[model samples]
Target chain A: MTFSVEVNGVEHTTEPRPGQCLRTYLRERGCFGVKKGCDSGDCGACTVHVDGVPVHSCLYPAVRAGGHAVTTVEGLATAGELHPVQQRFLDAQGFQCGFCTAGFVMTTAALDEAQLADLPQALKGNLCRCTGYRAISDAVRGVTTVETACPGRAVGASVAAPAGPQVVTGTARYTLDVDVPGVLHMKLLRSPHAHARVVAIDTADALALPGVQAVFTHEDAPRRRFSSGRHENPADDPADTRVLDDVVRHVGQRVAAVVADTEAAAEEGCRRVRVTYEVRPAVTDPEEALRPGAPLVQATGNVVGEVHGEVGDVEAGFAAAAAVYERTFHTPRVQHASLETHGAVGWLEADDSLVVRTSTRSRSSPAARCATCSTCPPSRCGWWRAASGAGSAASRRCSSRTWSRSPCCNCAGRCAWSSPAPSSSSVPPRGTRSPCA
Target chain B: MDLHTVEQWVDARTVDAWRPGDAWLAGGTALFSAPGVHLRRLRDLGGTGWEPLVEDPDGRLEIAATCTVARLAAHPVALFGQCCRAFLASFTIWNMATVGGNLCAALPAGPMIALTTALDGGCLLLAPDGAARTLPVTAFVVGDGRTALREGELLRSVTVGPLPARTAFRQASLSTLGRSAALLIGTRDADGAMTLTITAATPRPHRLRFAVPPTAGELREAVEDEVEHWFDDLHGHPAWRRHLTFRFAEQIREELS
Candidate 1:
C-alpha cells in the first residue's frame, strides 16, 4: 500500500511492501548514500534518522515507517549547507572508501555537544572497517559548532547551529521512510539441515496461500549455475551456485522464494513450501574438511585450493633465522552486519533481459559478463583450459631449449631444422647466452 | 498522531500512559538493535514535556527520566556527576538516552544503574492505576534485561540524596572501549558512617552500609551475603565478578573511611 512520508521537509506518497526494508526503498528513490554492506544489523552503514532518532534502516520494516519523517546523509545539510557533524568528519578524514560515511554522519548528528565529548560509547554501534576510528573520533570532536555552509564542510567552520525543538526531536527522514507503490513482499524458504539433497519438492500449497503471487523452485529456475562469490573474475572461479539448487550446502541457503502481496503472506508462503531432503553429514569446520577421513563437503573434496606464494625458499629462510616465531592466527568468520540487508528488485523487460537493482560487491564489470560468465557455472571450468594452454606452451619451449643444448645437434646436422627460428631479434641465440637473457 | 497510533511510539511520555503491547523507549539504542522483538508497539516516552533537570529544595538532585547521560555528567551532584563522566565510555549514542532509559533497560553493566544504586537513589514508579510508588534503586533491577517495572508502569525519575559531604567512585572495564566489568562507589557521611555499593558484578546492586567503618572481613562478608547472583557474560565470568566485587568493596570502604 502507498503511504505519505515527509523526508527532509518534502512529502512524497509511495507504495511499500511489508517485508521491503527502508534502506532499499530509499536507495530506489535515488538516495545512493545509503550503503548496503552486511544485510544484518551489526554494521551501521544503513543508519538514518527516523523521526530524528538514528536507527539502523536494515532492521526496520518499511511499513513501520509510514507517516514518519526520515533523514539521510543527503538531508543533513540545509539547501547545500553542511551540518556540523558532516563537516567534522571531512576535517578529521573519518572515512576512507566513503561507504560508511553516511552512517557516521547520521549517528554523529543525533548526538549533542556533551555526548559528542565522550563518543566511544555513543558510536560503538557504528563500526568502520577502515581508519581505526581515530579520525572519526576527531571529526566528531572537531565540529564544536552546530551549523555550516554545506553538507561537506570542515568541522571547525562557524555556521548556524542546528536549532530545533530538541536536537533529535523526532522529525528525521530515513531510507525506510519512503513509501513506494506496487511493491511485492518477498521471502525465502531456507534449508533447515546444513547439507542435504532435495529428493522431492512441493510448492502448490505455497502458491495457494492468500496474497501469494509467485513461487520459484529449482524446476522453474534457470538450469545454469551462477557464482555469488565476489572477485575480479568471478566466472573464472568455482561458480558453483544456482538461484535455486536441488542440493543445499548451507543451513541458511535459500531453497525457494515466494512473492506475495504482503510480508505476512510471503512468510506464510515460505512456511507452506514442502521439501523432502536426504540429509547428509555436514562439515562446518574448515580445518576438519581438509582431514583425510572427514566427509567431503563438495563432490571434488572440501579443499577449495591452497594459496602458496613465496618470494624466497621458506626452509632456507627459517634455517637462517636465529629465532623463528611460527604461530597461526585464526580469525573467525565475521559477518559484515551492514545495516542494509542484501536485497534486490528484479523486473523482466519486454525484451527478456532482466533489470536487477541489487546491492552487490561486483559493480565494475559489464552486466552481461558479470551475470552470465562471472556468476554462471560450467563455463568457469573453461578457465582450466586457459591455464593449461599457457603451461603447454612453456613446456614446449623448455624441451626445444634442451634439444638445442645437446652436443649431438652439430653431429647429427639436424639442429638448424629441429629448432624453430627465433620469432624476433630480441630472442637470445641458441648456442650462446646472449646479453638479452 | 491520534492516541491509537501514539500508543506505539515507546517513549517516556507514552510509557507513563501505557496501554497494552507498550514498552518504554529509552535510547532506542538496545530496543532498536534487537529484531523480532516481542513488543508489538512502542509507546514513545521520550522527551514528554517533563523538566529534564531539576535540583531539589534540600540541595539534593532529581533528574528527569528522559535526561541523557551527557546532561548528568555536567550536573552539580559530585558522586553522580563523576559517575556520569566515567559513563562517557558509551558516549556516541548518549544524546538520546535517558537516565530512566538506562536504568530500565537493565543491562547488568549499565553505568546509570551502578551510579544510582551507589548513591542510594530511589526510583519513582508510576503504575497504570494512577498510583505512584518508590523503590530503592538496588531493588529495581531484578536481572539482566529485567526490571521491577510492572506492566503499564513507568519510571518517572531518579532521585539521589546530596553527596554525603565526601564520596569517591572507581570503575573498571575489560577493553578501552568496553562496558564496565565491575564498579564500586563509596561514600562517608558526617557521622563517620560509610556506605560502599558494588555493582556491575551481580544481577542486582550489592550495597553495604555501616554505622561505623567496616573492616575488610566485614566488607567481604557483606558483599558475598548481600549480592544474590554474580553476573557472567562475554564481559566477565561469575567467579571473576564475585572476586572483583569483594576486592573493590574493600578498596572503596578503606578509601572512604
Candidate 2:
C-alpha cells in the first residue's frame, strides 16, 4: 500500500509489502539505526517514537504508522549535533557491541523529566547484553560525567571508546546491518525425534517451490566430521557433528537446509522437505544414560571423552583429613542471549573464491571449519585449512595453520570470507535524504 | 512472521459491521503480538473517539476500552495504578495494551479483570441495532481466553465504583519479573462488607463477600469453596496456588479488617 508518513520530520510515500511491520519499513528506507534484537516486542530493540510516544516498531504494523510522525535513533542527531540523551550516552560509554544501543537511545530520548525519576522502571523495555543497565541509567541520569582526567597514569583512567560517538548516535552498523544483494535466505528443517535413523529424504517438492533455489539433504552433503570447539588443537575435542547427519542424535538437530529468495519461501520450502526416520529409544537423564542397558547416543559408547588424572594421592589425602566431604554438583544450562545472534554471510567471488563475513574467536577458524568438512571423513583422519587469497592456488594438502576456512569442490565452487565493520575506515552513511519522490 | 492471512483493514465505527474473520484493533498490542492464521481482517477501533476516563456527578469512573495501561496507571485511583503494575510488562506494553482488550483476552491472571471485578465494575456492551447491555465484570469473563461477548457486540466502556471511601488491598506473587502466579485483591465496601477477588491461581476470577470482615478460617473456607480451577502451568501448581490463595486471602482479610 502506498501512503505518506513523516519520518524524522520528512514525509515520504511508498508501497509497503504485504504484512510488513514499521521496523522493516524504516530499516528498508535506510534508517539502519532501527535495530531488530528480537523481532517480537519482548526485546524492545526496535523501540521508536510514534507521535512522540515510545513503541516497539517490530510489532507495530506499517499501515498503522501512516499519517503519523515517526522518529528513530538516526533522527536523534540533528544538524550534525547529538541530542542531550545521545550526548549523555556517549559520555557514559553506555554501550558495548552497540546492537541494542539505538533502542535504548530512542526510549531514553522519549522520556520526560518526570519519568526520569524512575529510570529503572521507565527503561525496562530495553535490554543490553554486553553492558549492564547501570551505564545506560547513568546516561539518562547524566552520571559518569565524561571523566577525561588522566589521573596519574593511563591504566586507572577511564578511556572512551573511539566509536563511542557513532555508537551513541546509532551511526555504527553491525554485521547483520550489512546490505547484500541477491542474498538467498536459508531455513533449516530439524529432527523432531531425539533418537532416530534417517531412512531417506524426499526434497522433490521443496526444490519445485517457485522461490526455493536449493534443498540440501544428508544424501548430497559431505560426510566429513569437524569439531565444534575452538580449541587450538583439533584433537582436543571429538568431531561429532557433520554438516548434515544421517543419524539424528538429538532433537532440533539440522536435518536439511532450504535456501530461497525470501524468508517466507525458505520457511515454506523447509516445511515441504519430507524425511523418513526410524524412531529409536533414547535416555535423557545422566544416570539412566550411564546404565548398561541404556540406548547409545553416540556410536562410540555414549562417553565422548573422560578425564582420569589423579591429584596427588586421593586416598592418602582423604585419610589424613579429619572429615571427608563429597558432592556431585550440577549447573543449569544458560544461554548467552547476545543481542546480535551469530550469523555468517558467504558468497563466491568473481573467481569462485569464498568471501565470508562472520565472527569467531580465531580469524582462520571459519576456513579451518570449512576445511575439515571437505578433507576429513567421518573416520579419524587429518584435515587441512584454506586461507583467503589462496584463490585458485588453494591447497589440497594439510597446512601448518589449522584454522583457515576455504570451501572445496563440495561447496559447488562457492566460498565465503568474514570481516568486521564501523571502524574509522567504515561508516554507517546517513542514507539518501528522504527519497521523498 | 507476519499475519499473512490478513487481507483487509477496516476502520470500524460500530458493532453492526462485525464480520466472521474480523478482529477489533484497539492498541494492537495483543493482536499484533502474534501471527493469527485465522484472522483475515483487522477492524480498527481507534476511530471510535471514546473518552478514555470520565467521572460522573456520583464520582463513578468510566474507563473506555482504548484507555492504555500506561495512561490508566497515571490515574489518581490507587486501584488502577496497582492493577497496572500487576502486568509486569515493560514500558512498551504498558504504553499500548488496553484495559478492554485485557478483559476480553480473558487470561486468568489479567489484572484488569481482577481490578474491575473487585471494585464492582460493569462492562457496557454495545450490541447490534444500537442496543446497550451491562454485565458484571465477573459474568463478563467466563474462563481462560473466553468471554461472554456475543457476535457483533462491542465493548464500549467499563464503569467502576463510587467506591465510597473504600480501602483497597492487593497482593500478587511471581518468582521474578514474569507472569503472576497468584493475584488476590480485597476491598472493604462502605457497608463494612469485605470483598475478596481471587485470580491468577484460578481459571476465572472468584469473588468472596462477607457482611463483616470474615474470620481467618471463614476467609480460608470461602476461598477453598470458590476457587476450584487452579492452573498447573510453569506459573504455579494447583496445590501451591491454593496454598497462596488461602494465605493471601487471610492476609487481605486481616489488612482490610
Candidate 3:
C-alpha cells in the first residue's frame, strides 16, 4: 500500500520504506528542522505536530503517517515571516546552543497560554541542555525585552545570538545536518565485555556482504597515538588513545568500525564481524587502580600523570613550620554535557586536503586543535568555529581561517560566502571521519 | 527497531486471517517501541470502528482496546485520572499508547493492568474463529511480558466496575515521569471492605481483599505471602520493589481506612 502524508501542507504519497520512522522519513524529505537527538523519544529534538497534536516523531511509524496532517518546525512560519513563537524566541533569546530549540518550539506551539505557567509539566517531554530553560521559559511566556527576559544579565542592552533566527525557525544546521555525497556510513562494533582484550576478529563475512566498503580493526588503525583531552600545550596531554584498540578498557569501547554504503549495511556488517575476547580483571575503584598489584590501565604504569613543582626546598619550609597538616581534597569527575553531542564530518578536497566540520565552539581546527599530535602539520589541517561549545574539530589538509556562520533563516544564503557550512549537505560527501553524530 | 520482515498490514476487523508472524497493532506503542525483526505482518485495529468508551446506566464503563491513555484520563471518571497518572508518561506517550496495548504488552509496570485489577475488571478476548471469552484482569496476565493471549486471539475491550462511593489512593515510585518501579493502589469499596491492588512491583497484578481495613502487620503479611514474584529490572530490584510495595500498601491502607 502507498503511504501518503500531508507534511506542512504538502502531500507526499510514496511507497513506504520498510520499518522507516516518521522522523527519518521527514528528515530525508528535507524537513531538516525535525532533529533526532535520541531516537527513542528521550530528547524532544524530533518533536512535531501530528494533526495539531504534539508527538515525538521518532516513535511514530512512517507508514502510520498516512492521512495524518504533520507540521514540523520549518512549517511554523508562513509567507517568509517568522511565527510569533519564533519571534518571541528571538526577542527573549530563548536558547543557548540551540540544538534542542526545534523540539521546544514544536512543543510550545501546541500549548495554550495557560500551559506556559507550568513549563516544567507542559514541556516535560522535551529536554534542553544549555539554556537552563530560563530563556526558553521566557520565550514561551512571551516575555519580550532583554531586561525582562533576564534581569541581572543584559539589563539594558539587547543582543541576538549567532544563529538565533535559524535556531528558532529550525533553519540552522548542526553537525549531523551536514551532507557530503559518497560519504560511507560507519558503525562501531563495541566490546561487550569490559576490560577484555580482543583476541581475534573475523571480518571475512563482513567483507563478503554486499555494499560493504571496508572493515577496520585496531590492527589496521594508524598507530599515531593522540589524547582527547583539552590542553593548549600538547606536551601535558597524554597520547593514550587510538582510533581503535584491541584491549577494550571499558564496555562500549570501539573494537572495530565497519564502513558500508548504507547505515543498515554497516550495522549488519558490524553484526557479521565476529570477535573473540580474553576477559581480564577490572579495577573499578580509583584507590584500587593506584594499588601496588592493580591491573595496569595502560602499557605504562598506572600513575599516568604527576604534578610536582619544587619551590625552594618545600620540605625544609614544612619542617620549619610550627605544625604540619595533610589532607586530600576530593571532587567528583565532571563531564561537559554540551547540548550538541560530539560529532564531525570529514572529506578530502580535490587537492587531497581533508576538511572536517563539527560542533567546535570558537576553536580553530579539529585536526590542528583537537587531534593535535604533530602527525599532520597545523597549516595543512585546521578547523574554524562552527556550532556551540568547545566540542570537537579535526582536519588534515585545508585552508583553516574562515569564520563563516552556519546557514539559518536570517542568513541562509549570505552565510555561504566563504567555504560556508553546507546548506543541504546531505550525502554526496567525500573523505572520512565522523565520531558520534 | 525495524520490522524488516513485515510485508503487509491487514485491518484487524476485516479478515480473520492469522499468520505465524502476525501481531496486533493497537496504538503500536510497545510493539513499535523497540526493534522486532520477527514481526512479519501487522494486524491493525484502527479500522475496527469500536467505540473508545461506553458508559452504562448503572455507572459501569466499558473501555475499548484502542482507548488512548490521554482520552481515558480526560474522561469524567475521576478515579481514571488517578490510575492514568500512574503512567508517568508525557502527553506524547499518553496520546499514542492504547489501553489494550498496555494490557497485552503485559509489562508489570502497565498501569492499565493495575487499574483494571483494582476495579475488579474483566477482559473480553476474541479468537480468530469468532469464539469469545471474558477473563478477570488478574488472570489475563501470567508473568512479565507474558499474557494469556492465545495465538490469533485479540483483546477486544475491558469492562470496569460501577465506581460510585469508592475511595481510592495510588502511590508510585520515582518522579511524575517515566516507568514506575513500584505502584500500589488501595480502594475502599461501598460495602466497607478494602482491596489493595499491587502492581509494577510484581510480575502480575495482585488483588488482596479484606472485609475490613487490614492492620499494618496484616497488610504486610498478605503482601509478603501473596506476592511471590516481585519484578526485578533496571527499574528496581525485587527486594526494593517489595519494600516499596509494602510501604505504600501500609500508607494507602491508613489513608483509605
In what order do the candidates fall by DockQ, top score first?
2, 3, 1
- In angstroms, the error of model 2 at A216 is 2.6
- Model 3 segments beyond 4 Å from truth? A145-158, A307-342, A362-365, A369-385, A389-437, B1-23, B37-41, B56-59, B125-134, B142-154, B176-181, B215-217, B229-247
Q: Write the per-residue lDDT of candidate 3 for residues A1-437, one digit (tens) a residue.
A: 56689999999987556566788888778887888665666678888999998888877767788989999999999999898988888888887667788888888888876567767867877887766788888898888755433656655566566567788888777766755566565667787776888899999999999987777777765566655453455577676765566787777677776767776787789889999999998877889999898987787877768787887988899999999998999998654444444445554445434445655443342354433432334555434334442232321211111111111110111111111222223444332221121
TM-score of chain A by itself in each prediction: 0.62, 0.82, 0.80
Error of 3 at A243 (Å): 0.9
By descending TM-score, how would the candidates be arranged? 2, 3, 1
Task: For residues A1-437, write the lDDT of model 1, one tens digit per residue.
Answer: 45887766777678654335677767667665666545445567777888997776765555556789988877788866678776666555555434466787888888877557767767876777655787677777783323456666756665432322111221222212223344565667788888999888899999898788777667755566644442456545565655567888878676776767665677678888999999998888888888888876668778765787888899999999999999999987653332323333333323333333322222233243224422222222111000000111211111111111111101111111111220111211112111111
Candidate 2 lDDT, A1-437, residue by residue in tens: 35889999989788555466788889878887787666767777788999998999887878778889999988878898889888888888777666688898888888878768987667777888766777788888887745664756767567777667767666665534656666666667888999899998999999899888777777756677766443557777787767678988778777877777776677778878889999999878877888998999887887777788888999999999999999989997554565543344555444434444432323354456665664322232211111111111112212211212211222321112211110111222222111000
lDDT of 2 by residue, B1-257 (tens): 25555777767774446668787778777777775756777777877888999989997889999888888999988887878877856767788788998999999889999888888889999876679999998899999889999976778889998873565655556555567778888888778987898888888887878889988887777776877688777777778888888888878877888
Per-candidate TM-score against the hidden true structure: 0.67, 0.84, 0.83
What is the CAPRI rating of model 1's predicted complex?
incorrect
Instruction: Give the TM-score, chain B only, in order for the candidates.
Output: 0.88, 0.94, 0.94
State candidate 2's TM-score.
Answer: 0.84
Q: What is candidate 2's CA lDDT for residue A219?
A: 71
Q: Write the per-residue lDDT of candidate 3 for residues B1-257, one digit (tens) a residue.
A: 24445667777777766888888888766766675756778887877889999989987789999998889989876778777866755777677888998999898988899888888889999999999999999999889999999999999999988773565655566555557888777778788889999899899989999999989999889888998888988878888888888778888888888
Model 3, position B45, has a per-residue lDDT of: 81
